[model samples]
Target: MKEIYSNTQRAILWLGDYSDTAVPSHPNAVLSRGEVKAAFGIAEDLAADRHHDTPEDREIAEGYRALDALLKVPWWQRIWTVQEALLPKHAVLRYGDTEMPFARFWKAFDHYFAQSYRECCGEYWLDFTDTSSNVISCLQTAIDYRRLLSHDQGLVFSVLISTFRGRLATDPRDKIFGLSGLAGTLVADYSLQPKDVFMRAIRTTITDSGSLAPLLRTPEPDRAKDLPTWAPDCCAKLGPEAQHSWDMVWFGLFAAFDAAMGTKAAMLNPSAGPVLPLQGLLVDEIYEVVVHGICRDRDEFCAMARRWQHTTETVAKRNHGVYPRGGTYKDAFWRTMVGDMILHEFDAQGTGQSRRAKASDEANCRMLWNPNGDHSMGVPFSRDRQFFTTRAGLIGIGNPGPKVGDAIYVLLGGRVPFILRPTPKKQDGATLLEYVSPAYVHGIMDGEVMKEKREPSWVHLI
Candidate 1:
């Protein structure tokens, strides 16, 4: 499968059971191999005819059922198959006795996905309960995979990894090794030991690319103790709670710089390993770890609302009236974390109880607000509380682990400010900072601080 990345030659995709392959059975398999093959034939036919402009309701439901069954095959979940299927010149997916063009399959899947979203969003008149939840999940994974392959041809190494974080691999090392070819020049050595691959991939990508895009990823909870705080454990799962679409939250930063800072040329000696030599200006030091909960019940929602208000007041006081105009700073923060599209039911009062409302009072934020799960407007809090406010009074939400004394800085070419924890070592006799992660400082992320004439300086990240 790794060979597929280097081979630009044409390839064919065989989706049916390969008797010699030792891949494990996926737990979500609900249909026999033969049954899946048969379903593929029906699905292919349905997809071809699904575009009839005025189809009956019963006809559309039948199409959804057939398409759902075909998507459940184990082939979609494997990590290795991702590059193999996607990089091929022209591909056809075959299940048992049926075959169809991969492109046609996706076009059909897109149609069903649109219908599903509308029904789930209640924009369509039909009820959404008829479709199975498993089908919805399968379609989403497939779509995400397609999107990952379709875009991001020029993105740095770590950003590419973030694109496919949820994919499963039997060997953890394969997760990094698998993308060696796709990430190309960003990875200096794909031959490194599996355990060492992630470190090399991360260090090389950061220095070579010069962009702090890697720090934007949400780290896996069980991150290896030896791994630097700046590097993400790409091998582990992001869990269901992680907002996979955080790129949108940091879009404000990109809007200012138009790109992340990082060059393909090396800034330090290649012989020097592990530690990175970065030059950035120190913007703020974290003085407090703000705690806030998900909007579970009315009280939590009100609390979150108050936090928004407090952040606005803090921003206005510190920045001297420079803040989001027309919309409150709370709205801007919400747009930074979530997107701008507010769910009509949540914001529109007197609209009766929304069917999308969740019953649980626990701190499960993803479900309560993020019904679409796309990180659009109204995302639930990933954790019960998140970190915010450095000693400099810079208030913004960040990854869960930053603490007091950690420093926030704006690296040249970095779209957003990064939070770094000081490490106990020096790189070639110079002080170094251990990169914590990128942050969402409400006023600074969008070039507001640069407007105040702050000069750039060196800040090493260990």
Candidate 2:
């Protein structure tokens, strides 16, 4: 196992080296016909954008035209033409890949980016390189490759390296140490200092934690009114052990974060005063709230669902696309909410409500939380609130309140049902009915609701 893992890691390191060496200092040396075409395609796409009509746009347009002309030339002449076009004498040489000319070597680099790497490198290997099974695992990998190499982490890198090396080599935890070593080497190669690399890693971790912390911190107005009404009665049905396991998994993530902070802090500058230890503070607060405030009450599960909904809504409001919104927010929101909701709902309601109400709630919650409706407007909070209660009730998660579904399940007990119609009788035997879950049903409903709400759209809303 050690040999196999070591060989795999070595291969990845070699690939990194190969990728680095392939990049050329010059923008255009000799590009393949396909490379020229790809560049031209990208340029044309940019030119079509609304902002491309300015004087700057025209200048860019002229460059693209020149490149397009070179692309049209015969293969041999085309190569020479691009080289001449990107020569040092040309004022635009400074632009490199942008407007500058490149020699044949640089052109090859551009071509490499355009190719499908899966075909050349093998998809299985790439998956292994990128798979992240835990928060710490992902963080450590990102720190090595993305943060240390791409950003700053000088102090953090040194601390991580020192700590990792000091660990007992034969210990089970040495895998983590080995991973840290790899990260440190990658960062050093990328010209990032230890402090810069680790700081960025810490920042990235904090940025992710920020989304969940706010939800955890929110308080329920009256415990009596909320807990019994929202708590799933199916706990007795699922058995105590299963429920306890579920709670352990949920809270364990928080505990892991707390445990990781001390190691993370060691990477920081000791002399630096705390302006805002935002990441550390947020992690501590989330754990406190979850363990003390939410976990103690029967309504705590419902509270968690409500918190997720609230946080999703807040993030969505901030990101309603006058400016382009990346898919990260949606991805993060869905993964965190869906995983927690499903597990918690299972704990609360057992297997009985798992298929329908829980599923339906997931759909409706996604719909209500969607910031982008076809109507090009935000959904009203009033309508969203109604959907929350209705959906939660249907799913068997909880009753709707301002705080409901924010932390627990976005839909609580409200899942839409798909009842099957009976099939016509067959000659061979009796007819039967089958039910299927369609993917777009919830999305369509959410779109309709957004259209109904018709709130004003704005840039920089978030």
Candidate 3:
């Protein structure tokens, strides 16, 4: 597939015959080839509205609908098509009666819709518009990746996997196989079990980089089953609240928050079988854990708020009404709920675009108070994360339903904290730890654990 695309003068991405969803075939949806070229020429916002009462707004909205239909085609979802789209000299996209150069479509969609997906992928999980926007934005990055390839610039295996994890394949092994051109060829044996194939990829990556930073980008658990817990599963999807995703985007690896505080990862030998030896400081043990489904509606959002309020009241009552933080217990609970992460504000009086929350947001104690009834108001993290209470009064969010007693640690050369579950089993006379998931703890994100006088120790992970 790569060879065909790389050798081709121009690649035709025929979306006309391939759609993942039913599309409207109304006369209004008739975006003739000329109209497509004109739409690509449009540099300003289309004044579209859901109310569709005005003819102008309805026309604009219908136009976007046509484009969105094309973007949803399964051709955009295939993993192999990434190489197909990027390796070619020029790619032309066609759907229905519209045909335009990929570049023009990218430019036009970027102006109106791309930011919604690039920025708020998690917040708009159910938004039909953002879905199309995400596809195009990812396509643009794939093109940029081709540029990096041409420049002899290298991206780590983890970054490649983390960045494009959601792309699907008929054969599960193709998930890694499809990325071989960009990620450098791995030990390519289809006969090997998927676990072994995945393990070799991790081993190859670790050997090449000499850093376990790949492990730092923990994939959501219960995927790529039978693979060692420590080895990252490329199969994991990158959700919006994914701590590692935010860390990579908002703060470049080790630039903003180094839980290791400038410590380099141990150059552990990968040839030593599946057990990975790592150096890190054990910070705390999980005492209590909480997991909630992504709030689907205004009521669910309010219910989650009530639950948070209950937690705050519990904390306040336990502390004799004067919680020992910079603010009230309600403030602390809300901050901990969102991992103190940045959140775009939504309310009645203020423009929904007014301001994102400050890092240490004390003012959003009235967080659940969304008079505008915006579902996104208090929902910064959900679906894949679980709230947890550490043994030492630390509150944070983790993945895969953090079990009680799971040990949290700041790995050397890691960008975020990781939780490792204790096993009754031992390996080579050492206590074995099973990888739980990557975490987003509020207080310990910026080297707070490293500040403690505790020394780093070697732990064995499987």
Candidate 4:
């Protein structure tokens, strides 16, 4: 499949005969053919829109309607379309009287949305619903990859699984199989059950990245039947019990933190399945924990943020009336919300600036927190995480928030701190444990515990 697309010059994609925006203007009317620079939209880029859309929304409604019609076609919903549309040099979307370059159709829609984002998705994200398990949201899987692949970015296996988890495939196993062509990670194996396929992908991701961090991003491993505690459920999705896509929420985990401080996974898989060794330092025990509800609007997000800020202040004061690292409680809480990842794209004047590495300026983070300010900057936050404190007064955020007394550790090969629950059983003279989740605790994220000279402790996790 990779070879075939590589040799092909142009691929004519039949988006079905009913596509409304299939032929925008005409086959010759490739609006901004050379001008459209990948996907310019607020969905991923968060377009720097201080004064959104100089034109009225009614003027841009046609683009949304066109996108609405194109998304209605079945071609955009398939998991296979990821490689189909992405691998080709010139892919055309043709339907009814519509025949437009796929890039133009996709970018024009994205560009329009970016321009009028405040009017469209700024309030409720209702129109596009990027997080929802619907057709329109599913289209984002293709759009994001198109941008990634175009710029020649490395597509890691677990990140692809995280990106395309919401996509549809005729056979369940195709989830891994479909994305394998994008990056030569997993081979096509029908003999493998969906469980084995997913496990293989997890193993491959671990081997490639040399980190067990992907396991932490898995929605909840305890819920899987046959998979090990360290195996990520590459197939988790928005089912009846789920409302938000965990894939999209945790996708950033691939490049976000340094819990183990660049330590490679020094793991030993004694059996066919994975079993985590207990040779990690016991860091802290979770104390006060609060599992937050999802924020549906700007006002709700602000209100909940304030409440979280208030709680963090109380905990910080009790811990010593100051953050152990010397900053004020108010200073640290805001940084923790966004996991301290800054966009490095925006300046004080709200204009776009280019920088290659991570920026430490607090004002840039504050810029992201503004509801009316430019968000082209990366202000990554998830309402699904828990705001919790440790017995030692350390504040942090984690998923599946471990119970009050669940242990936290900088496990071997882990890029971030992991939460483990103790069990009655013991292994190899160490305490038996259950892998709960990965965490983002402030202060200790930079390998401070590993720097301390002490006897190593092993945790036996199933």
Q: What local lDDT score does residue 2 receive in model 4, on the 0 to 100 scale?
A: 76
Each candidate's number of clashing pairs is: 12, 58, 0, 8
Worst 10 residues of 3 by lDDT: 43-52
What's the alpha carbon RMSD for model 4? 6.7
Each prediction's TM-score versus the true structure: 0.69, 0.19, 0.71, 0.75
Q: Model 4 scores what on Cα lDDT?
A: 0.59
Checking candidate 3 for backbone clashes, the offending pairs are none
The deviation in Å at residue 159 for candidate 1 is 3.9
**Which has the greatest lDDT?**
4
Give the Cα error of residue 311 in candidate 2, in Å: 13
- Alpha carbon lDDT of residue 244, candidate 2? 24
Best by TM-score: 4
Give per-residue CA lDDT, model 2, range 1-462, as digits (tens): 223443432111100011122664443434443444444553344333212223345444454443444432232111112112222222222222334222232332223222212133222112221111121122222223323343223333322332222122343233222333332323212354333333333333333222211111101233222112211111112112222223222221222122121222211232232111211110000100111132333244345445655544554555561112223444434433332223222121111111212434445545433433121011111111112211211111111232222221111001111112233533225333221111111221122222233332110000
lDDT of each: 0.52, 0.26, 0.58, 0.59
Determine which window of 10 residues in candidate 1 has minimal summed lDDT: 346-355
lDDT of 1 by residue, 7-117 (tens): 646555555542323562434435455455445644564356333234355554454444455554556556676666656666677654356777666555555455443
lDDT score of model 2?
0.26
Instruction: Give the lDDT of residue 310 in candidate 2.
Output: 59
What TM-score does structure 3 among the candidates reach?
0.71
